[model samples]
Target: MNTIHFTNLPDDLPVAENEEQKKQELEFLKSAFQTFNETTRHLQESYDKLQERLNALDLELEAKNLELEKNLQEKERVKNYLNNILESLTTGVIVVDKNTRITTFNKTAGIILGMTAGQCLNQPLADTGIQPLAELVQSSGGQTRMEDHEITTRDQRQVHIRLSASPVQDPAGHRMGTVLILQDITQLKRLEEEAQRNQRLRAMGEMAAGIAHEIRNPLGGIELFASMLKKDLAQDPEKRPLTEHIISGVKNMDRIISSLLLFAKSPEPSRQQCNLNHLLKDIVNASADFQCPDNVKIHHDLAVGEAVAAGDEELLRQVFLNFIRNAVQAMPDGGSLRLTTQTGNTADSRSHITVTVADTGVGIAAQDQKNIFNPFFSTKDKGTGLGLAIAHNIIKAHQGTIDVESETGQGTKFIIKIPAWDEN
Candidate 1:
């Protein structure tokens, strides 16, 4: 504001002015004083209005600050929620930015890839040392999705993987990054293959059973004719030997046909309380007299209390005998043959009979162990290759399982599990 100065008298004021002039000066003073009073009032009114505007601005700023803070807190809560969901998933999750740099690596991702999150997070996909994932992500710039793509893990275990790649975009439809989902389907794949293999085996078994029936028809006639011939040639020594040979060949063929039928068309085992201890002892005695070498040492660990099984006694005996013979065959140059039996209950509270036939001899080749129970698979030249196969069928018919464990140059062990008889 500009200041105004007032004086008591002007420099050119007339001396001894009249009463009217004095009165005029007084009125001028009154006017200047009135104007000063009005100016002061106007200034006060303006200051009050300015104060109101400042207070309003302060209120607006505070409201805006609170709103901004709330938005930030909500965003943080959402981020944590999403992280929790990703972490809890069994399937693996990996995220990459537009530059193919890994942005998020979940725990499942770390486990499936056999790497740590720190080893991959924020790193370029190309340098992560996981080629399958890198190539999959780089394929079509992560826009194209790959589903159920199988990949072998770093540890060389075959894993069935269902991998998918999807692009991440912002609300404005702009390209942001990519997301990769991984799932382990190894067990599912094994079950699928096992189902397919079982179907094939079933078909093959049906065909073989039919062929066995067809062969048996002719074999019955041959045996009858050979018997008649043997009697007719009984008086002639040379001719009688030839007829006997013919009959012997027919019998062997019939025996093989019976074995084939047993393998192909497995018979249902008669449910009975089979005492494995007595059965095993009888088999051991028979083997000692026949197939078991004099140099081979036999050790039995058959306990007294491990008694009964819910299986046909004859069939169970056949299974155990087959295992014993295989174990003995494995040891040609004198080795220990161990046979053990025990009764145990499984986690499901079902009792089972555990039998192990192990030997200290040249072991089966690793490749052959899987095929040992398969028909016509044998490493020995004289092997008809049906012994273990028939044994496997009988065990299966009795609701049992058989598995072989062996390594090249190491001893082999056969583990058999059968459902035990419930006395209750």
Candidate 2:
């Protein structure tokens, strides 16, 4: 082997190293560089695209969050509005679960039921202790409809309540609960009752006046002839008895005619300032002369106040006398009669004095109660039935009112309200 220097290379030495090897080395190097550059560009493009996608996603999420917040706010607003409406409604509203447990009770419900929301909430229908309501709800099936129900209050007051019940259901149509709307018909019922009474009174009055007018002439002739016959038969003993009977009958007929006249006449009230307490005391004193039974007891609860009213004294006296007499007659089996007088403001904010007569006697029937103030409508055989009618008219003339509360076999109470004299 010849020891040649590495720096000293001969041109075209070593047979030119194979052309195929050189070409292969060059091709491999070119291919590696191209692959590296392509990978780098692809990574950069992919990163940029991922960054754009992330930004778009973030924007979308932000918009979705805002939309969600808006929806929540709108829902809250709707909820608040509904709550306010329910709170402000005059008619009572109550929501109950499927088990009839109270879920919500509004302000008016509190007043009508005489119970607070705190007391009523979560209470079962049976636990409410309202007999009418408990019975009604229990009997009502899964029917979702409204019905009118009458309930008696805790104070023994009759209330006409209109109960409207609707079924609460889920979006899937599954039965959830019930929503009950309570409407107070006490005043409405009273007005209806008053209207009916007035209609009956008008009809009866017209008929009575017509009949009385026709009968009065005949009655007068009968009385005149009876008087003349009594005078002519005075000397005949046998005819005297018959004439006496005729005279007695004529006098009775005259008395009936007088009552008829009183009934037919609708006198306008001549209002004057008078002390009601004194008048009530006089009425009590005058009642002593009445032939009341020994078993009946009368009590007076006259409040010490300025009991001045603008009304007719004589007519008012008759009104009270009729009430007292009726009360006395009510208690044939011995019961206490209480008369109370007090001054108060009416629901309409009118200053008035109230006189109440309560008797523990067989009460007027419900059917009869509506017609009690109509002329010729009487339960008693002998009653002309115009006493209450006249009393009703007298109170109305005075711009006052009269109401009766009664339960069959329980008792009866009559309330007379008259406007107080305005000193100012």
Candidate 3:
């Protein structure tokens, strides 16, 4: 192999003019080739470094994509779990966008409003046809929290509902939308009204007790004087008849006063472990004097198990007697009076004995059911309206509960539950 050396080139060689010029050009070409080789070597090294950097970036991008996928899956799972919880909740929940369009509605909200989520979503409140709710939200001015609003449904059924709405915002405080929560409070409202009624009845009972006591002594003396006056006027037949009528009327008023006194004076319960079945039998026998119409048949289903309760025997008897009397009155034409006893456990797992008095009679109207226990509130003209009221008070004093269920013309059932004493 022949290698060209730059230093070996002749500076001035004797030759023809053309030959000398060619030699100079050849030497310059050799020098330029050496500089080109050095440039190529530098570029090859830079290309190798760039390829390594590109490979590193590619691997980093793959890792980042995998991490993003994992985060997305986690977020999806969390969203589904939260959605399931919201759907299962009993309280109704609805979310609306800033434009008043429905964004989300849970299953409970759908059921409560009598519409499906698909029908409600993305629709304006007005278009949904819930007029009361739409008007309320429109009046809220983007936010409202209302408690215990009474509303009637399309079916004309009254309901007490609580509403709460708050504006939803993003983390940076940007207005997003609104969230509404709804809760049914009809039963709670009824309970509050019942408590107030019971308070008033209690006050009345106390006052009646004082008045009856003061009037009873005078009434007894008057009855005695009237009887004596009638006996003295016996010789005068016309006068005797008039005096006897007065005596009889006065006696009837005195009897009513005595009964009022007995009701107002709540005797201390002589509590003992007593069989409720026996007590119920006694009540049935005593109620016969009320002259229940012939069409009314009485049936008893006493539990074979321990039908035991710790309460005053006489008071409990009176309670059942009052209930039976009411049932008889409800069915003027007569109906079936079925008495049943069952032993069960309470929600808290405490043992209880339940006595039920059911009647096939003209059932109480739903509107009047809530106030049935209020004193002086009665459906019957002949009733003083104190029977059921006093019965309720007696049951309450016994640490028991009396619940009634009735539908108009269907029937009425009263369940009295009393806790069983500890079997110590």
Candidate 4:
């Protein structure tokens, strides 16, 4: 602190000293005022500029916040869209981590696999009971695509599948897991098989036609001569055996020729409203005298009343006769034969009569089942192999289908469908 001491001369001082002191004080005050004004002006300008900069920053911050919220909403929308697509896909989609634990099993996947998404998620791929998927995980090196891979389900139903797999990776190319896409192709596979079968049948029919024409004339003469020889040697026991052998051989050849012709012929069915129940009864009665094993038993489950079908009675009779004969022959060891007939509607809403011939006999081998209806294909040593083929043709001519269900050692069932009489 600076102390200023004023002498008594300040009240009444000498003229030079007083005037000088007063002038100096006045100059000092003017200088202080000028400095204060300059400082105030500088501070005001700085404050104004600072406030303007803060306002600009506030505006920028608000804009950024809005933009950030918009980006977040857009990202959320994209995420939902992707999720919906994954859920809606028909192909089974499965995603697993590097440890082979399932992360995502979509709705289609759950349905096709006979499992729920909740049941499969977090479960190991190997534990999912899907061998192809597990194999994909084990063999996953890079992207892989497989088609028409067959798999049997837990219920013993076979399914054909197509699979595509790729390893999920990050931006740095580190392996994360696998993404698998599965599609069911069982129906498509059946169509292909049917197409192939039709082609083979067409060719076989053409070939059999020429062969039947060449063989039938000779076969008729042989059968005639054998019959005459049998009549001439009827009294001689030793010669009778030879004649009988000749007669049997000729008869067998004639049957073969006849079967071949029947298989090759495309007969236009003379459609009629025939009662299937009566037809089936007539078939059973006609076969009553046919030689079957003594122990063999035949049971009937024919639908009562009018089991009417629209087809040529003769052709249908032949079809049923062939089926019944096969059933009887199959039960060589004296097993039961069930003949069932019922009325039903097909998938296209057409009424049809279904006849099931199930026999507890030596069942057809799995490998031979597909070719059972093909010409010249038979499992029996004495079978001409043309009976079922002819029966198939007749049923097809009537716009129906024949299907067989059999497993080795489990007997066999033949289901024949013939459209019922529709007046409309």
**Could you say which candidate leads in TM-score?**
4
Tens digits of per-residue lDDT for model 2 on 1-424? 1122223333563554645555555676677667777877888899999999999999999999999999999999999999899899999988888888988889998788777889889989667677656555555565656677677766555678888777778999887777777889888988997888777677767777788788878878987887888788889999878877886876776666666666667868787897788887787675564565789887889868678888889888888888988888888799998989899999999999999999999999987887788777778867778788889888898889888999888889999999998866
Best by lDDT: 4
lDDT of 3 at 273: 90
**Residue range with the least summed lDDT across 10 consecutive positions in model 1:** 1-10
Q: Give candidate 1's error at residue 418 in angstroms.
A: 2.4
**lDDT by residue (tens digit), candidate 1, 1-424:** 4455565655575656655667876887687777888888898898889999989999999999999999999999999999999888999999899888999999898788777889888899777566677777778573767767566566654567888888888999887888888988877986785576557667767888899899999989988998999898888998888888988888888887787777777578999888888788888886453467798898989867856888898877777877788778878888899988898886677888888899988998755765676777888866768888778778877778777778777798888888999877
TM-score of each: 0.66, 0.69, 0.74, 0.75
Q: Give the per-residue lDDT of model 3 (tens digit) for 1-424.
A: 2344555546576577658777777877776777677677777888888889989998999999999999999999999999999999999998888787999899988766667888888999667766656666666666665655776654455678888777788999887887888887878987897788777776887888888788878877887887899888878887888877877877777766765666676656777897889887876675554555789999999899779998888788878888888888878888899999998898899888999999999999988998788776887765667778778878888878999999899789999998775677
Residue-pair clashes per prediction, in order, are 0, 0, 0, 0
Candidate 1 wrongly placed segments (more than 4 Å): 1-69, 97-102, 107-132, 138-157, 170-178, 216-252, 275-304, 327-349, 356-373, 402-415
Better of 2 and 3 by TM-score: 3
Candidate 1 vs. true structure, TM-score: 0.66
Q: What is the full ranking by TM-score, best candidate first?
A: 4, 3, 2, 1
RMSD per model, one decimal: 6.6, 9.1, 7.0, 7.0
